[model samples]
Target chain A: MAIYSYDGTFMGLMSLIGFLEDKQINPVAICDKNDLVTDLFEEQEDIKTDEKRARELIGRIVDHICEPAFDRIVYGFLSQINGFEMAIFNYLHLGLTAGENVERLAGDRRVAPLRRLSLRVGREVHRLKGFVRFAQLADGVYYAQIRPDHDVLPLLAPHFVQRFADQHWVLHDLNRSRAAMYDTHQCEIVILAAADSLCFAENESHFRDSWRRYFQTIAIAERKNRRLQQQFMPRRYWPYLTEMAERVR
Target chain B: MILADSAKYDVSCASSGTFRQGRANTLGNATYSGICHSFAADGRCISLLKILMTNICIYDCRYCINRRSNDIRRTLFTPAEIADLTIGFYRRNYIEGLFLSSGIVKSPNDTMELFIHTLKLLRHRYRFNGYIHVKIIPGASAELVHQIGFLADRLSVNIELPSRQSLAKLAPDKTKESIIVPMRQMAGEIEMYKMEKKKYRHSPNFSPSGQSTQMIIAATPESDYDILRLSEHLYRKMNLKRVYYSAYVAVNHDALLPANPRPQLIREHRLYQADWLLRFYGYQSHEIVSESHPQLSENYDPKVNWALHHLDFFPIEIHSADYEDLLRVPGIGMRSAQKIVFHRRAANLSRQDLRRLGIVYKRAQHFITINGRFEGGQSSLLHSLLSERKIERARQLHFDFNDAPSAVQPSITGEL
Candidate 1:
């Protein structure tokens, strides 16, 4: 009957899970430090992050379970859902105990929540890959902004790096105040301020107007299903889209 | 906007089935799993910058709004202008690639030459490695077609009407031979290039994504059976990647065309479903629609209708049935069937196991028996239940005009 709290980073969480497994002690709950509720009778443990220990734990999981299970754990952490740390800890506990056959227990109640949360995060990552719209800055860098429901900036870097290998781009996650900057050779994540003073290229609005005109013209009058359109590209993403900027005007 | 609105009648905007890895010093690459950058209000995927190169036409096709007789403003984008626009849009990730089509300006060769110039500028000058789909004007010479095919990823030649008689009545300028000859040539060249690539590792790919064609539905008297058979022939004989069905939009009024045209979206949807059956489900066209039944029933889907007509195939044992047999059962798609085969090897499956595999057990319960026990009703009761579900689904498919807001409606002039 003990609760373990970590520093809310993925490395910190993995280190705490590694320490618990080494001690062979199961905690009643695992959460971030901010989510801890003080109880007078319950015992609480504060775990510090160890980079080497976290790397070794991730390598062990990849060796014992599967690579996809490792991805699932990372996605679940990125989901930032309440009580997701415990769900991931339980999923890893089952995987380690069940050996290589843990994937067969996917339908089990203990592992289903982790799968669902990971799927939701994966869907948001896929949508942002398509929904991200870049505007040319005066310095010849492609600049785009997104306000996603989950922290998906880490998941979007490898994709854009492969696709836009010849140009410099910056993708800002406005919700989290983080940005992924790519310099045609490497990508780095940094904290960025709001882009109120950023100056765009002179012809940026002209190209945006052309895209808006094309978007408005291609839809057929005979069959208009705005509900379906909104279902795929929700209104929350409209602020950054060049085609939707005309509607605001 | 004028070019895109006029080009909306053409419905072959697919950006999938091609894989080109991103290279250094290049802007983008194409993946097998196509990315839809946006969706139109018509519920269709917007994967490409679908626009016409020029809207001024020499032919007077009765169903087209850009015919010579129409009183509409005309516009033409030069090769440099088109090249710049496509590059600008691609950099912003607003589109997967460019879908370039044009109306006949002075002659077929002249129009095709313009398309070739634009493709050359995009592929050579700008060094764009993304997906590009170009339309082949009918009656274009072989030299021009080959040059265009070498640069573009996919090519298409629209068989505007289904039959020759319909073409003669609507578009007198186009003949059946003019369209079919170039299609046959492209197919032959594609095969030749494939063989050449095997011999030489770096032989240039010819239409690596393959060619596709479009047919307007409800404009002519062609039945669904005719369209399915034509699609079957194109897939087997010409090796087309896709066959798009566009419901006829009556933008122009003429005596030869229908006075009041209705866009039969359900029929178009059903045709796509049947097309999937032909391409992926390993079902022949004759099995789905025969000469006796020349049309698909609007009440039930083609797969369910086939299952209902052949009642002897029901009640298959879930444990012993083959993969193809499992596919024949309702609610078992390609992925679920694969999952069933994979999961059953580890454990004997039950009704709960089937549900966990993502099978729609409500529809599948009537067709499968778990461990030699049937949970479905008698034949008459089962038939009634399936029919009731079908009727409910059909009613839900109809869109209510009153429920939609007025702001979303298209203007009376058909301009956005």
Candidate 2:
């Protein structure tokens, strides 16, 4: 049995899938470079990221399977779950063999786990779109920080670009040390340091105080259900939230 | 703090069903499916910055802490302050928009003028294109209401109580005609604007999200039947997008009002479920609640109650039943019904297929049959099994705030 290892990028994983298809070799397992377990008896192959091969695989998936199904594959890859690369590879394998009708096979064990993981990634993206709080910097740039479980910076750029089109803003994902910066017109991703030294605009605290005041005051005392609150906006996200920051501090 | 805490009793914080794309040089956009920025300790959604212009009031309502007689701190936000705050918050993506409600200061017209002024500054000066929902004081003039309607995305006039008699008893200053006239005028203006948009593409949108109203439940002795019927009337006649039900939280001590009143959350939840049935599931108010059965069953959900009562419609063939019939079943939701319709074309759906379609088979198995074979056991056994699940759910409904994790402690003292 052959074990294929690649760099933990979506492009690298896609290239490995492409290589597997070209070589007609079904791997026993696919692991990220960090997650590789050394086994003396097993054969291991290291796959490098090939942009052309990755693009070809994406084109094939979009043409053979549905477009949304391709989106699910991307979302599933973004989820960063263990063994998800192989899960997505198996799902694509099944989809290619079964043709367009593979999208309807929800009950199939091979496709269901990938679908569920992609759904989770989609839900996290949707939640972060609402939960992201931007604090204006001294330079008039709206700076916000998030620590999402998955790599959602790529998914969130287009939304903020459409919504806050006229403003310069930076959405930093602290977990990944990556930021999506939009300078009123275009958006680009860059490596950003931890945002501890940024100077906020004057009166930023006043608006944040008012928001915290509003958040606190708007909850009915008689129906206080912190469980439900934590269920929707989990406690782990409270530190970055302006309204919940005071409590955490 | 005082304004938002007092306004907390007014539950209508949804910022959905309106689509406004961000324009060039504009600040923000509004989505049709609203985004909840956060959830409060009470488990309520914090979508809009729901606040009041001022907490001081002239009218003395029995259920209000902000009544004329109540001794509470009074503060008002200036039009510029409101505009600045809304724009600042919008730029940060902290809220979908603003839900601006206010207490009647000197008169309805005076208070409405303040709202209109604030809206003007936010719209014209700030160039804000986000969702804005403004409340119309009941006695505000038609011209003022129309002017505000054109500026705001949505407008609402709170019919605080369900019936005219209840309004007279609890809130003596508000009359049924005074509250409803603005609603009717706004509805007419909305219809006219839709027609005008067709004629002239650049016709300014007039309350493009339409109007909605809130009714305080359990404040009076009105049953669920009265509330649902009134909601139906509002939806059918006034063209209301939503009818919010706010469970009464006793804030003031009055001889007429009940002392230490409990917020009927279960009843409110049931009413919202029944309202969904009325709006989406093709069920009428009277069908869900009748004069004979004036209240929804506290033990079971309204859908299950309806399904149990109408056993004659049971054993619906999974393949043969149409979309409407599928929705009528107890455990089948709207999405599952649509999924079944889409899936059955490719293959015959079995019990496993129904389960995979996300149907609650524990409840649906009693009502549905696959290939004319009943997977559920005897009728009595199925009933007992369903009842057991209902009782388990009912037990879980008593949410103790103390049991919540320490991360979400009640830090705000504004709530009464």
Candidate 3:
């Protein structure tokens, strides 16, 4: 399987699909590998930044395929952080094989990567449904922060922005070094001083304290599934869970 | 002819329903204002003000975070605070509406009362008419439920588990009663309003947009078959708008729940896929699941699974299969199924033409043939292919992004 590399952005990935259209060369599989390895002779390659190539890909996609199809394939590659080349190829292959008959092609084998990514992100969003915490800044920014595995910050912003849009708020995605900052008119990205610049509000600690106590009280010891718990919320995220840390101590 | 389909949808993304559309000189994220800067799967924008009313819940459902015993940060929002916040958001156009769910604080009625009050203040006092989706606590009093409908646009009560036995084991505080009673009553109220409006031409609308419910899968062993049965009942009996299947994730290491938090999303996907069948496909749960496979098939979708299990339904002459029979084919979805029905009315359909009607040749080819030309896979497929269904748990996602994998990793308590 030859791995293809792109600029590692959504548009760049789309541009790669543009390459596929331009050359009709569908690579073995497509994905965006954060860690790119150039296998000198093991693979035939293309770097997708040329404007002409990018335009062709976008043009072919919009003209032939529906707009929604590209969105999923691109988001899947980004979310799973899958092999971008494979991800791209699989997406195009699924679309071409299925063509305008998009709905029926929903669960085809080729599109499994994207479907899995959707389900994975779906589960994470549900888990974090309860985990999002707000820290009232000294300056009254009402800052909340998260460090999700995928670039979930972009995914999660609309929820908080809609809920907290009335107030100036900053939801910092520390992993990607960006924040979804909702101002008076629009929400944009901001980089914090560090995670430390943010502080819990006057009532925030009380809330966290209450939450810690609540978390400890709910578990049925006999039903404890450490492995299952670890699997859903990798122990990595525990550092930021108020209740879990308090209970451990 | 593969129409190039690249997929992207961050699952954690929600399109905001903040009603920020008509705010005058005031900052507000429109109730539906979370302008889906990006549309995720299910074909909706990925912008919405999604959050809980407060994380403080008196009910300790084993699957939930707001439960009393869960060691998580908890917060409470006063009506004034939420109203002020919503107005600020409305001015800014940051969201569409508020998705506020809460733990059972004090009692179901109390929590529901608080939620209703917050919504009321957002509406009457602040004169805000954005989208407000309040959680109707399952065991909440009838009056509270009624008041909630009057205040909010959409109300939902999560049917967290499929069966009562499962609910008791994992979410001890919740029962089938605590969950379904409100749904039943809310359904009645909605029907009442619908009837009154139909007859009198005008009446107080109760949940005009209607009620919705959610189920947590993989928290218990109820098969997708069973889950679909419950969903079918909720749809038919409860008259729900949507029955959301939130794949279960392990927030706590609850012995009663799955040891791992990752939900069987393929199962969840199968359920949703089946759900579309029931709601739109003119099929029933019993039609899909049987004594043979009480649980849904892990490999293929319910439709494809059904088509494969019963070859008799196969090759329904694409040219002759009635609209309903056409739908029975594995790869034919709502659009394609209808397309074939419509196009065939005009002329005789052909094998080459099935693809034009939107049938995925691989999955549908065997089950359907336009000119009696079969395109089924040659392989005797084994059980469903299992790509890692390892759901990323709450443990990983619910953290301070600032808590990097460094010496400065913040403690799990959401502290700096």
Separate DockQ for every predicted complex: 0.61, 0.65, 0.04
Candidate 3 lDDT for residue B53: 58
| Candidate 3 regions with alpha-carbon error over 4 angstroms | A1-249, B1-45, B347-353, B371-416
**Which is the leading candidate under DockQ?**
2
Q: What's the number of clashes in each of the models? A: 0, 0, 109
* Model 2 stretches astray by more than 4 angstroms: A5-8, A19-25, A33-40, A45-50, A97-100, B195-201, B378-416
Candidate 1 fraction of reference contacts recovered: 0.67
TM-score winner between candidates 1 and 3: 1
Clashing pairs in model 1, backbone N/Cα/C closer than 3 A = none
Per-prediction TM-score, please? 0.91, 0.91, 0.54
B288-341, model 3: which lDDT tens digit per residue?
886666877554567766665566556667777788887786667778878776
Query: Model 1, range B52-127, lDDT digits (tens) per residue?
Result: 9999999988888988899999999999998999999999999999999999999999999999999999888888
**What lDDT does model 3 reach?**
0.61
Evaluate fnat for each of the predicted models and list the values in order.
Answer: 0.67, 0.79, 0.04
Ranking by lDDT: 2, 1, 3
